[model samples]
Target: MASPVTRRESRHFSFISLPIEIRDLIYANVWAPKLQLHVFFKNGRLVTAACLGAQTGDESTGTRVPSGEEMTLADNRPRGWASRDLVILRLHSTWGNHYRCEEDWNPMPGHISTERNACISLLLVNKTIYAESIRFLSQHLEITITDTDTALYLNDDAKPVIHDSPPPMIPRQLLRSIRSLNVTLFGSVDLFIALALARDYNATTPLEVVNQEFQQKVRATMDSNQERAVGLLPKARQWHQIWPGIAALPHLVRVNLWMNHSSFDSWSNINERAILEPLQRATWSPEVELVVYLPNIASDNIVPGEQFNNNDEDGLNFRVVRRVRCPDRVAEDSRVLFIVHDMSAREQEEMGDQGLSWDLGEMSIEMDRI
Candidate 1:
């Protein structure tokens, strides 16, 4: 008689063998909910790293906004409320300082807490997993450009600021793969004073005197226009530098322009044209979406009349206006869609139950069809 053979039950599960839909759900659970990346130049090479800061309005963590001087640091810390579910990249200096450089991109230890670690190692498991992970990331990734140096670096025609041995180049494949981008047009608070001086100066008046008078006025009144000018004056000079690189991106599905100025009504026709005209001429595919988040201003500045009111029973917290190409003007340019969103509403939505309380407001913009 032969002894009964004992068989072992296999405990290992094949992740790749699962249906793709099931695999995707696992990927989503393992990966960061939203990956916040900052694009800038490092050692003459284009680098995209995780931004450092608490998620915006994350009161539970008790992280306060960085001071003005700290805001100027090269680490790309958030100036105000930070975005949520940001996955920190190991390449950032802050991350390198705290953790071993050899480690993979992971959420900062003390920052936002996470239940499970990001399974970035799955990319190394095999070729199929790598391709699938890349595909998943391309769809969820968001790149943010906040500095002029990065804008210049993105521009192919712009001269290299760094005289390093290797010529500056953003990886062509990476640029093509990016589906979403966030650009902040507000360079600095000082830009407001510059714009104000430029607007009030007369040829006969000495520049210094004009500047002094304006400073006094700002000190006395603390006018909203001064703060609003932050988004206006820099467009013509800086937008072109950034636009070329943005337009050249072949696969961009959405481009978000953050205009941090206070009131849309304060924008002059010239300034409006300076901003919108370039967008109208973008070389991207017709399906590309453009969303401009206007500054949060008083209700008085936003709702001029009843016509602009959206009449939402929810009390008009956010107003969304879509711009579509007119039927007759189809031949003039590609059929690009523009969505003007109120920043306050966006912030509230992002912050969830913890968002700042915003006063009700309505805003409108009139524009010629693209």
Candidate 2:
């Protein structure tokens, strides 16, 4: 049995080891539904998990302990109390261990999977890592991918292209098994469009037949577990349709839709309101908040002029920015909006608001549910 003194010391040393907020973030991230750990903390205790990550539907291999490439099988097996304990022992709040992340990787090419196996097998072998990962999972509920390369970067020689590998070969199920979501996308708006569409049309991803075929299997797993998340990237107007569906997901809270301003904004004209009007008219939930990040823009000149004066007596603060306009029929939560105009108020006044149309580039608006 764990003594109160030991628990206190462990909690204290851990609390001091990292910033309170950082520790809280890590704990929250680890607890999310997108990190593919088959074990988690339940009611202040560790519990076994069903084989939610087995996308290939091959549990037979999961039962057998392969010699060197044990990761494949271990990663697919039913995770139980034993697996939880293994993570705890391996991931206990040690700074050095956290840095090394030796528990996170293996000596061989397929060690990430082995790492999973080790956590589960270690529990089967003894009972250290199971306890450790669980504690770590509960403690680090959220973690950020500070690395520039991969969100969950584990470099290996055999780490073939994730897109090329079959679902059985890669940890695709690992995505749904995750308690938190961590992902990174590379390339332009086209890439973003593709990624978004993948999440939206995952049931029938247009790019490949495999993703479409596995849609039902993936959905079934999520509905059963009710503790998983999926994260991806997709850019373009075709993919934009995805956000509405994602908004309906009670399970999804964090998402990153990185985009580059379209040609519409810079190609001699602006039509911001034209784009948002349809979204406002169709469906936009009030329960979501958004962040508009301005990347790769040298000056706010591209943002355009304010067509409307929100400075009126209504005190309902608003800015009629160039091309980008507010939705005509905004949900109650959409009332509070921010216009990111880098130009000075004095310079803005000088423009004389001549022939300004609300039509601008794509207007990304965040909605908050009261």
TM-score for each prediction? 0.42, 0.26
lDDT of 2 by residue, 94-210 (tens): 111121233443222333423233233322323443444444543333222212222222222233455643333123223222233322121222232233233334324454463
Candidate-wise lDDT, in order:
0.43, 0.29
Q: Compute the lDDT of residue 354 as modeled in candidate 1.
A: 46
After aligning candidate 2 to the native by TM-score, how far in Å is the CA of 143 from where it should be?
9.7
- RMSD, one per candidate, in order: 16.7, 22.4
Candidate 2 weakest ten by summed lDDT:
325-334
lDDT tens digits by residue: candidate 1, 50-168: 54421221111112222321121234453433221121121112221222211223434454433222344566678888788778767876767765556555555635355654642
Query: Model 1, stretches more than 4 Å misplaced?
Result: 1-19, 42-127, 148-175, 189-238, 261-270, 296-370
Model 2 sits at a Cα RMSD from the real structure of 22.4
lDDT of 2: 0.29
Model 1's TM-score against the true structure: 0.42
